[model samples]
Target: MMSDAYNNLAIEFCGIKSPNPFWLASAPPTDKAYNVIRAFEAGWGGVVWKTLGEDPPAVNVSSRYSAIYGKNREVIGFNNIELITDRSLEQNLREITAVKEAWPDRAIVVSLMLPCEEHYWADILPKVEATGADGIELNFGCPHGMPERGMGAAVGQVPDYVRMVTAWCKQHSKLPVIVKLTPNITDIRHPARAAHQGGADAVSLINTINSITSIDLDRMVALPTVGSSSTHGGYCGTAVKPIALNMVAEIARDPETRGLPISGIGGIGNWRDAAEFIVLGAGCVQVCTAAMLHGFRIVEEMKDGLSRWMDAQGYRTIEDFRGKAVPNTTDWKYLDMNYKVIAQINQQDCIGCGRCYVACEDTSHQAIARLVDEASGKRTYQVIQEECVGCNLCEITCPVQNCITMMPQQTGKPYMNWTQDPRNPRAEKVPTAA
Candidate 1:
């Protein structure tokens, strides 16, 4: 029997076929021909080439990275102020030709961002098509550097600019045009709608957000040090997944851009993240920071794992239920108001480290208490019940494995008439009049 993961996997990005719905996002590593070709050889379904732009006539700074890690030392968030590729346009084109020739089956998308003028886009669009590449993606989403040069996020932040530039590409090129939008804008739907209005074949996001890494206590420098200084860079990684998914859903759920093809990008490191993007209505998922951190070989795992998961769930292909999870999602207001639970402490397995208790008392509801017994000389903790409010902080803060758990409370209680959860009190039964 095919695993649930693999049984259902098909990707059609702008008429390009993908064995799976995952693609590599444009970034530094995927910027050059060598890395991209290596990625293709490693089983990636498609690649959105690094953002190619009109020569800035400037060189980028060295060492650009900002990271936020969880307690386990795993990097949960990342930021980078990387500029476009420093390589010459001809060098990129030459490699594009060779890579596409070798991997004709894989989708090759060239990400381009040039001056906003019609001539600049018109000049590059046709040359990009001649590369034998499958399509062109307008890079309106870079959060830094390029935007200052009158491209990237500068174009994306304005609806008119988005529409005008995308239309220019559509007019100048026969190849499909995918508009990549920045996540920094207030309303993502506007840019997505603008892309559609401009006659774009599809829209992809989010091209990172403007970010400030950290300031050096002594030297007053930000992260990804460029000789004791830094500027706002793009923020990404698993930390940004929630934000990306929400933006994609907004576009998917919007009346105007609901049908707009979405290539989801951000924090997509593994198959599960990719699958989540799919079920939320993204046409395909893209990776950048993940590939940069783990290497192109990670694609092997992403494909196999996603395929296995689909087969296990009885999905025969990607289309079997790509957006199956989106409909069930709802706003907080629509959530059931009666749901309640209290955290349970597993005493038998409890290590008594008190991490949960400290966390609860200090930052959360004072829902837990530690007790001491002189007879046994041992100590343990218990939930205070009335104060829990079911926030699950104790569970998250617990040191031992599964030491703290949450159990749903009995329903049909008298409704609490708070502002957030309005009063829906049950009517008292009364004797019927004869």
Candidate 2:
């Protein structure tokens, strides 16, 4: 039985114990008491409550959300112009207290955004603390609508502001403080280092990239158009996973913020995505766009899939594979320049598709040859090894999986990479006898 496996997936993040590492990100899915209770019932281990600010919350438009569809009409990307929770601060706090009281086992971290003023943070800190939530996530990452009010990315883009605000939260709140970072800045490390310097217990990222999903060419208006006007909102979903992973790795591997715990958030929709983030050094992962698309019940699949995969891989717990991939991530200069591989085709499994041949001949290196067999008058394809650069283009173009494989060339050359290659101008030289 999958349940019979002795895999311990529970995690302690920022001093809060979660039944699992899957937490609903502070988006629409975790905005209300009903949503959070449903999420917990759906098997989610935790949730970061929707961003809260001072009372008299910001107004929202009728059509505040838009989506980017794939060729099959799947929501590959999502965009939202919605601001923080539009409910009264007291109502939100009351609900948080009630929910936390009802489900004390589940992690409840409230997401907060206010002016960067210390007093503003001070004023709200005690109210949130009174709720008995697990922690506080500083909303330094919302890309749109909130920044104009001097919150959200406005405070995040500035490292000094991030540090100051984080310090203020830490000073006022006894709960663990996590700084949710914005990805808009040039170097993500600056804010990450700043969060660390400010004594953040953990850092969650990336909030969202500033994006204009699409424009109606005929109308000349952007999407989620309200009265033919729209502004760039936050973009999330599968499309942002790579960006989020890179940022997480940047923080995990940086010397300054090396040991800082990360709560990975970006385009995470399934168990594999969550596992990838965990392996990349995220103690937990936050899901928004996926949950928004598929609903809360998807956590059942995420939990089951992760548990089964971990059992099969002999991982006794989440920590077994957590951050294991970090060491493998290195600079491009360290790549082995002498490594070589040649494409080989399995004639039986080729399916006679000309995709590989056409792709290689037209768009990629011309390395595949189409020939005819005289015996049965059948067409056969082969790889021209000499011209094949092992680019994997032919393999990727092949419709049939495993029909094309790259066979590594056995080169006697030592593992010398671009950084040490004599051809490189910046390569270090070994001293020679005069």
Extract clashing residue pairs from model 2: 237-267
Question: TM-score for every candidate vs. truth?
Answer: 0.88, 0.96
Give the alpha carbon lDDT tens digit for every residue of 80-160 in model 1: 887887878888888888888877777889988788788888888877888998888888888878778888889999999
* Global Cα lDDT for candidate 1: 0.82
TM-score of 2: 0.96
Number of clashing pairs per prediction, in order:
19, 1
